[model samples]
Structures are given as structure tokens and as C-alpha cells.
Target: MLASLRQERILAAVRLHGAVRVADLVDELDVSDMTIRRDITELARAGLVRRVHGGAVGPDTGSRPAHEPGFEAKRSWATAEKQAIARLALTLVEPGQAIALSAGTTTHLLAHLVAADAALRPLTVVTNSLAAAEALHAAVTPAGLDVILTGGVRTPSDALVGPVADASLAQLRVDTAFLGVHGLDGDGLTTPNLLEAATDRALLAGAAHVVVLADHTKWGVVGLARIAPLDEVDTLVSDTQLTAEARRALDPLVGRVLLAPPDDPTPEPPLDPGAP
Candidate 1:
């Protein structure tokens, strides 16, 4: 392929995936690693992309606000990865424990999983997502589940954030906080909305353990406002697609990194009729 055509293909992949690894690009473009690296360097110098540890990210166009995608829109971005992360996050919760969930598609999926699990009932859930509250409310069945919705101004992403939400979080503490963020870089977890950042900080303060739920796509991206540094995170749950460089960078900063397995669509086993 011509040099210009290969570069264009690289840029297209980066834009489609938000981030692209060198190995993946090599396989996609059927080019040598050195070739890919040279192309990426040229693109970065041209201000069309930003090169990171293992890959390149599309340059911020400054046209749209960072991390401003609507909740519904994000639901389809990484469906399988979000589902896998949510499943892993559920393992961190125990019955009778109080957990706080920050507003985001991953946490919203967690809320749904928590509601579906009959064994993890009789728990308290505090959240700033109206969607999460409704899911939890409807899923209550054999066990009692308390859902607390923080009242505040709603953002375009469907997150409730403001003085009211911050004040509410200040007055309460929980066993864990499962947060969803816009981006995760060497600096820390971040979001584009300033008010949401404040509210997220409050959520962190009110929890004994802070667990961040982010997909691989979020890596290397930085948002407008900083929430907290990577060291502040007690745990980070992400899908296996996360790069090795990300693991190395996060290992020292985060207390633990749990990579959820890839989503497999195998059917569940049948119950034992006589075992019970």
C-alpha cells in the first residue's frame, strides 16, 4: 500500500476505536512494526494523533466537549466489555453491605446485575443515576434492597450532580463506591463535566473502598476536569482488552487491577434436580 493510504487507514482505525495498539495496527494493515511506528510518529507530529506508550489516540478536535456522550449512546460503545466489567464488579459486593454507584453506563450495568442476583439482596445502594435507581427498584423481589437517589441537577449524561448531591454524599458513608469515569491517564481519573467531577469526588470521600469501572477504550484519554489521582483508587475493573502498558502504569498507582474475562456467549448449565 502507498504511504499516504496506510497512514489514512491508521488514522481511521484510531478514530474508530478511540485508541489503537501497535500490534493490532500491524495485523490490520499487514505492515511491519517499524512501518507502523514511523507512520504513527509522522501522524503525531502532524497533530492528527497523539502517540502513547503502546499506541496512538485521535487528536481532540476541540469541536465537542470531552466525555460528553449521552448515557444511551455510551451503552452501545463497548457493550460486551461493560457487561464483563459489571460482572466482575458484582463480585466485590457482599450481601448486607452498603454500596455507592456513580453515574455511568458501566455502573448502570452493575446496578442491573446487582438487581438480578438473588443471592446479593438485602443491600443498600446509593446512587446519583435515576436510571440505576429505577432498575434497582424494579428488581427488588425475594430480598429487600434499599435504593437512595441523590437529588441534584441532571447532566446530559443523565448524572445528577450539584450542591444537593454533594451534600447528600457528605452526610453518608458506604462500604464501596463503584465509579465510572470518562478517561483514565497517568494523571488520574477524569471527566469533562466540572460539577460531575465534584460530585464524583464526594462519592469517593463517602466510601471506604473506591473502585473505578472503565473499559480499555478509556485508557490514555484525558478529560477536562480531574477527579482524583490514580493512587486514590482502591481497585480498577477493566476488560482484558486493556494494554500491557496500561497495566504497568496502573500497577503501582492502584491497589489492585482486576481484568474481566472476555464475554463468552455460552449457555448456562442446567440445575441439578435432586442436589438441593
Candidate 2:
């Protein structure tokens, strides 16, 4: 963003002053002396600027950071969207119900929603995500709700996977499984990590109703391993901003796909993922 802004400012100055000095604009732009100089050099390299005395100044286009959210950065964007999905996921729960929750920040938000839930009353929560387990443990354990964390080899994202987690998850039956994925494609849900993929597969086997909780961005991304076929999911909760193609593609796979309304408190239509 800083790079993009500098490019714009250099163009504005060139247009206004017919070639402004980097030194002259430095004080006006409130930018660092080094940053101004670097921007000028970069612009000149891209042919957008003409180097002048002690400065540089032109239509040089440079790359912008891919919109991929850093962990902390993503925690903010679509927060409301994730929160709504989490709320919808919570409504799927009932006291004494046991559900499998997956990894990812959105799932962490779901854990938070479950914790604050007054009406859901109580339930057992199973998870492989360290972050999700941390959040759920804090809420459910204090309230006497059962919380299970699968033990396994820890991955970079702090997700537990491999033999231990898989065995633990396989040993129990859950009422529902709330899964978050890196991507959901025509082929199925996928993950970048092989261990996580195996654990996800286990989650699918041990649950009665499989609910996918994802925001809109996860629609088309294809990852390394297939967790499950799209048709296996009983419910999908996502923001209404899903593309038309995504809506069409997912409609046939899920028993029902739910789009959380961005504004207003209106209740969404209930899906009859009718008794299997």
C-alpha cells in the first residue's frame, strides 16, 4: 500500500510542478526520507520517473501485495461475515450435543460463538485446532461442558494431526461436525496439509451431520488433498456474497446451503437436511 501511494504521489507532483524534487515533496507528504528516496528509485526503474538532482520522479507500475490476508490481517476482514456464520453454526448445536470443529480462524470464531451461547446451553466439542480448542476450553470447561482436544503431531498452524488425533476422533461419534477448509471445489473440500487432510477425513467419518463453515473466499480454491466430496456435506454456512457460479455449483452438492444475510436480524430459512 505504501508503494502504491508513493507512485500516485510522484505522478501528482510531476503533473503539478512539471518535475518536483523528492526532497521538496518529502516534508509535504510526511513520508520518511528513505522511503521517499526508495519510491523515487523504484519508480525510475519502472520508467515512471525521471531521476533529477538528489531525487527521482514517471508511469512506473509496480506489483502490489496479493490480497492474501496475513493471519492477524485476516482476523479483521470478513470478521462480521465469519461471526454470522459462527452464529448460524452455534444454532445447529443443542445442550448435550457433541460436535467436531475444525481449524482456521473462522472456526475459532465459531468456538467463541459457542462459548457465549446462552441458549445452546451445553455440549461436548471435539477439535484438532489448537486455537479452536483453546477458545472452546476456556468457555465450555468452565461451564461444565465437555471439550475434547485430539492429540497428534502439531502442524505449523498449530493444528494437531496424524495418528493420535485421528484415533481420538475416530473413537467417538459426534452429532455434528463444523469444518473449515482452505478451499471447496467441484471435486470436494481440500487442505494444504496432508495430516490435516487425514484428520478432516476422520471428522467426516465420526459425525452424523457434517456442516461446513466457510466465508466466501474459500469457494473456488483447490488445495493438495481432497478431504471429502462436496455431496457429503449436510449443511454449508457462508456469507451471501458468494458468486452466482459458486451458488449453482454448491446447490446440488449440499442437502442445503445457507447464506447468512449481511444486515438485519431476520432469521434464515431452516434446511430440512431431512432425516437420513
Candidate 3:
């Protein structure tokens, strides 16, 4: 393929996925690694993309405010990776534990898994995600689960943010909190919305442990506001697509680093067989 065509394909991928690894591009374009690297470098120089350690992210992901896509749109970006991460996140939940789930597509996916798990009966779930709250509300068996939704202004991502949500989170404490972030890097977790960053911080404060659920694509992308530094995270559950260099960087800063297995062909089974 011509260099111009290859570059256009690279640009399209970065625009669609928010980030693209050179290795992935090399495979997809059937070109040498050096070829992809040169394309990424050229694109980065032209201000069309932002170069990272092993890949390139969309131009908007630099110091500027990222375009926060709606929850449904974000949901379509990484369905397999999110589902795998959500499945891995479920293992950390114990029966009868109060947990907090911050608003994001991945956390919303986990909420459904949580709702369907009969063994987690008598569980209390606090969240600022309208989608997650709705999922829990629809599937929760009577007297088996309690769902709490914070009151606050909603963001484009369906996250409740502002003083009301922060105050609500401040009053409650949970055994664990699963955070879905827009970006993560040496600087820490980040999001496009400033108010959402504050709300995420509040959620972090209320949890005994913090587990961030992010896919490979978010590894090097930075957003408008930082939520918290890497040291604040207790565990990070990501899909297998996460790079080795990222894992090495996270091992010391994060208490635990977990990579979810590749997606299973069969549907996920229930957490437990016993009824609530």
C-alpha cells in the first residue's frame, strides 16, 4: 500500500479508537514495525495525533479537553474488552459487601453482573451512574440488594457529578469501589469533565480499596482533569491487550495489576447457583 493510504488508515483508526498501537497497526497494514513508527511520528509532528510510548492517541487527548462521548457511544468502542474487564472485576467482590461503582461504561457493565449474582445477596451498592443504578434496580431481587444513587448534575457520560453527589459519597463507606476512567498514564487516572473528576475523587475517598477498570486503549491518553495519581489505586483490572511496559509501570504504583483473559466464546455463567 502507498504511504498516503496507510497514513489515512492510521488516522481513521486513531479517530475511531482514541488510540492505536504501532504493533497493531503493523499487523493490520501488513507493514514493518518501522513503517508504522514513521507514520505515527509524521502524524504526531503534523499535530494530527499525539505520540505516546508505544502508540498514538487522537490529537484531542493532549492538554486540551477531550470530547466526552455519550455513554452509549462510549459503550460501542470497547465492548469485548469492557466485558472481559467486568468479568475479572467480579472476582474481587465478596458476598454481603457494600461497594461503590463510579460512572463509566465498564462499571455499568459490571453493575449488571453484580445484579445477576445471587450469592452477593444483602449487598449494598452506591453509584453515581444512572445506567448502573437502573441495571441494579431492574434485576435486584426483593430484599437481596439495595441500590443507592447520588443526586447531582448529570454529565454527557451519564455520571452524576457536583456537590450533591460528592456529599452523598462522603457520608458512606464501601468495601471496594470500581472506577471506570477515560485515561490513565504516569500522571494517573483522568477524565474530560472537571466535575466528574471531583466526583470520582469523592468515590475514591469513600472506598476502603479502589479498583480501576480501564482497557488498553486508555493507557497513554490524558484527559482534561486528573482524578487521582496511580498511587491511589489499590488494584487495576485491564484487558490482555494492555502492553507489557504499562504492566511494569503499574506493578509498583498499584497494589495489584490484573489482566483479564480473552473473551470467552460462550456466555458468562452466573456467579452462584443458589437463589437469593
Ranking of all predicted structures according to lDDT, beginning with the best and ending with the worst: 3, 1, 2
Largest TM-score belongs to which candidate?
A: 3
Q: Which parts of model 1 have CA positions greater than 4 angstroms off?
A: 1-4, 9-46, 49-67, 141-143, 264-276
Q: Rate the local accuracy (lDDT) of all candidates.
A: 0.82, 0.71, 0.84
The per-prediction tally of clashing pairs is 0, 6, 0
- Arrange candidates, best TM-score first: 3, 1, 2
Whole-model alpha-carbon lDDT for candidate 2? 0.71
Q: How accurate is candidate 1 locally (lDDT)?
A: 0.82
* Per-residue alpha-carbon lDDT of candidate 2 for residues 1-276, written as tens digits (9 for 90 to 100): 477887788877876655655456677788765567667767767777654323442332111112122334335445667777877777788887888888776777778767666676668889898777766655665555778899998765557889999999989999999998767868888776778889989988999999998877566555566799989999999988777888889998888998877864733322112200
Candidate 3 residue-wise lDDT, 1-276, digit = tens:
998899999999999988887768888999986688678868878999986534777886744434566676577666788889998899899988999999988898899899888887889999999888877886666688989999999887889999999999999999999999988988799887899999999999999999999988778666788999999999999988787878888888998999988865646533222211
Which lDDT value does model 2 have at 84? 76
Ranked by lDDT, the better of candidates 2 and 3 is 3
The better-scoring model by TM-score among 1 and 3 is: 3
Tell me which residue pairs clash in candidate 2. 48-58, 48-59, 48-60, 49-57, 49-58, 50-57
In angstroms, give how far residue 48 of model 1 lies from its true place.
Answer: 2.8
TM-scores for the candidates: 0.79, 0.68, 0.82
Among all windows of ten consecutive residues in candidate 3, which has the lowest summed lDDT?
Answer: 267-276
lDDT of 1 by residue, 1-276 (tens): 988999999899888888777767888889976688779879988989975534677787421444366676566566678888988888899998999999987888888788878788789999998777766877665557888899999886788999999999999999999999988988999887889999999999999999999988778666677999999999999989788888999999999999999854632222122210
